[model samples]
Target: MLRVHFTAEDLARVRVAPGPDPMWEILLSLHVLRQRSAAPVFGPWRTAVRATLPDDTRWLLQLAPPVGYSPDFLTPTAGSCPVDAGIEQVLSTPVASLRADLAQLDCPRPDPRTDLLAGGDTAALTALGDALHAYHRHALVPIWDEVRAVVDADRAVRARSFLDHGCEGVLAALHPTISWTRPVLSIESRFPQRDVHLHGQGLVLVPSYFCRERPIMLRDPSRAPVLVYPIARDVRLTCAGRRSLEALLGRTRAAALEVIAGGCTTTELARRLGISAASASAHASVLRDAGLAVARRHRNSVLHTASALGVALLA
Candidate 1:
């Protein structure tokens, strides 16, 4: 363990939520870069992208470069195999041939947009986007499977390296408290002592790339588990149950309930719905008080499950 000082309050604040600070976003971007560089294939890449940090920090900053500047900007020299060659090869192979070999196969027809986007024609960007969206929905599963195989093999090596180099502590620090609905990677740490206004432990990971210098770590004098990590980026989005539910129970509260679908921790619910953890907790509290949701403690986290009332309302 690299002896980094953190208090109990620091640890307590690390619940996952939506709408992460700026630093968390940066770390996610770096992770994305690492993912893209490692696999350049589909399955492992998607799996790596879907991998979540298993810590209790709620906020995550998602780093995204300008829309089109991702793997394209990081292309290697000519003659090098394209990162997605394996996916392309599989996708290009005759569907009947693939179905004959792979059991439980249900291949869809190829969309033109993927080919157009691959070609990078300015005139075809719109059509390509539409096609890519369709392709992503249909073809992503198989492609991700292929990418995952490569990514997993690489991760095994990296995991070994991480374990050997006393990097597990660092890895632990990077573990997220909550999982995001979208694919993301993020950093985590405590806040500065001066800004410790929140009652409970509070952790923050902003976008890493945006921070020119490392952030100051905030520790509670009371020796609480509060910490901070200067991250790269996090993802944020508003979530709601279906619109009908919203109409029945006012949008604000309905949106809160929608995000709690799988019995999420209060912080997780907040993060998924892109609201403050406090707000999420308050909303959940109201729902619980009304017998719309029930809170249960699992390990150290408090998770909320939809009650009969909630189920009926949502239904």
Candidate 2:
């Protein structure tokens, strides 16, 4: 069990990332590629993108072992950071810190890139950056649409939970592998069990589409404490599923729900669904009453969103 110790101040400061981290997606996708069997949530992605992996992914494979440390700089303190910022941080790492972090990995002596990083070798760093960019392009970008949908769906669900049940409820129900007990949160980890004390820096709970079964955290945990965990649901939306949705919820209502899932005003929904404003209002009312959609009025316009229940059923 990996236990996270938090203070009252930390509780007050807790935050969850609004979306998936591009850096983490790149790193964790490498882990998925290396495996033949991943969790059900990643199966479709793995199958879709496996053949597209570049041969030169060793740049990532070097650090991301199946079971070992990857450089901590690769996993930033901010739960949501741009890819360039993360890459720069890794490249600018002090020589001592770079080597020290890599030393924890279960790899052989002297990671060749460590020397290049330590020496501030610009040419080697560019090659490294290029390698990452190349890997992401071939492996992740193709399936990024799927990735975004999963992360967005997860965020929507969690936001609903927060609204319905408050902070404690959200934490308590984050994942089946996680247990919340007052100021401490525990997660089952494949790594050697450890305890992390958050010295009042609070914690960022980041939902990840590619983070596998276990919840991951910074080894040092002294700065920007974060816990990256898998999101809810295993089944993803498929073309076949979309085609069958009309069967499940009728053609017009299904179309309305589909548009509503991405968020739309009733007028927008009606126009998109090719129906009158009154027809759109009726469909919206039915969905809302069924607990499958929500509509909130802003001035004269009404915005409709698929409820968590709605998204789950559609998925």
Candidate 3:
């Protein structure tokens, strides 16, 4: 069990990532590649990426084992940073931080690459940057649109949760395995028991397309506190799926769905669809029942939004 202790200030500081963190996607994807048991959701993705594995990318696997410590420098302590900015941070990691992070790896035998990285060799850092760029280009760029779509949808859900119940609500709904109990958030993990206290540093909730099973945290508690959790899987958009959805929901209701994709209250939806408020609510109910939309009560108003699956189906 992993426990994250938070202060009142920390709770106020908690916020979700604006979008997918490219470096984190790369690191977690590498960890996924090392796994023997394949998640049904990622099977197709893994198969596609594996077919084009580049030799240079293998070096990352040595550092980021499937179930062990990965260097903290690989994932910089920034929220929703671009791939280039993230890579630059990794390359510019101070020698002390690099050496300290690498030393924590529980490797049984010494490796030359690890030694060179620990010594802060400029060539080694350059190679690491190149590998990151190459792997991202080969393994992630092709499927990035899908990844971004899924993350955006997940963020939508979280944003609603936050609006409805504040930071606690968002944390409560993060994952089934994670429990938020007032001052502490507990996460079940395969590693030994540990605890992290966010002394007003807060926690950044990062939604990941490649993270699987449970949420992941930086091994070093001293680094910026982040919880990278898996987003809803199976977000593939197709014209056929949209056509089928429209056929099933009919034309006017389908239009309601399209409006809901941007998020709105019942009054806003009724105004946009030029329908009675009751009719708009009824259409939203139908869409919600079909698992295409979610309705959350925010005090006196109920806000409606397209679900991740719903957004994917539409597009």
Candidate 4:
């Protein structure tokens, strides 16, 4: 894992000011760098690329928008989104073209074991690297600049509010490296840390940071393992107990628990089930009272994770 260092002041500035969009800027950078570096050695490993960054463009778009803003801004019809429909079309064409170009490039031919490795192959590798760099410099950078200009203009105020709310200090403590798809911001205090994960549809803001020092393996064989950090601590800030849970969990608390095996915030659960946040909270209360789930405080929100009993009951 590569560590990117930053001072506390830099962290604070990023928290307040609009920084690079992680999904488009950071993750994409990593993607290009990986392809340039690893493709020569590994022989064009597409799965490795997908593992690090999922193939879902919409998911990536969700994560790429500016910090503190809703993913709704990226929706095509919504004027709220930074990219206009016309601009989106323009930006997408080059990306599609690049993908096609890369796909057409020659990889290890069939029966490579029988073929002799040529010294001249280095030229081909060098050419690919130069092409990738040129694409990044010309196509990607321009599009990114356009996107950032619009997003930053709209979100400047909200970004400042986040900074005022101690986001800078939180980011300083966490010192997370920026990425395109993984837009992260945190606020740490003695009680719990607040973390926000920005996606295309919406932002998932956890009230407490979950400190998982080790990397967690994902069930998806195609995806890379994600390092689990404390994104939230006690989630009770949004849903404290049975009453609060009741306000959230809704009628089918048992079924919901089954779906959200890991845990989910009231907002996330409500959105997923097409219910209101208040209703979701109510459902959670019943589950909590029935000893099916546990609610804890993270930072400003509450998160509910299934208890072993809850899982067994669902089972």
Score every model by TM-score.
0.23, 0.75, 0.81, 0.25
Which 10 residues in a row give candidate 4 its minimum summed lDDT? Answer: 203-212
Best by TM-score: 3
Each candidate: RMSD: 19.8, 7.6, 4.8, 17.2
After TM-score superposition, the amount by which residue 114's alpha carbon in candidate 1 deviates from its true location, in angstroms, is 75
Each candidate: what lDDT? 0.38, 0.73, 0.83, 0.37
Clashes of each: 81, 0, 0, 52
Order of quality (lDDT): 3, 2, 1, 4
lDDT of 3 by residue, 87-185 (tens): 999999999999999999877765677789899998888888999999999999987766775676677667877877889988988987899899999
lDDT tens per residue, model 1, 203-299: 4332222221233222223332223333322211112445533443767788877766456777889888888989888888776655556564433
TM-score of 2: 0.75
TM-score of 3: 0.81
- TM-score between candidate 4 and the true structure: 0.25
Whichever of 1 and 2 has more lDDT, that candidate is 2
Candidate 2, residues 117-201, lDDT tens digits: the string is 6566777677778777787777766666556655665666666667767777778888889899988898988777899998888
The window of 10 residues in a row where model 3 has the poorest summed lDDT is 234-243
Ranking by TM-score: 3, 2, 4, 1
Task: Point out where model 2 deviates above 4 Å.
Answer: 39-44, 47-50, 109-111, 241-255, 258-315
Per-residue error for 20 in candidate 3, Å, reads: 0.5
Candidate 3 segments exceeding 4 Å error:
108-111, 234-258, 264-315
| Residue-level lDDT tens digits of model 4 in 1-315 | 322233444333342223323222322333333343434422332344435442323223222222222221111121122223323432333333333333332343422211211222434334423433443343344344333322332233233335555553333333233232223433222323233322222212111111122111112222211222222122221224566445444556656776555567788888887888998887777666655566654347665666545556567
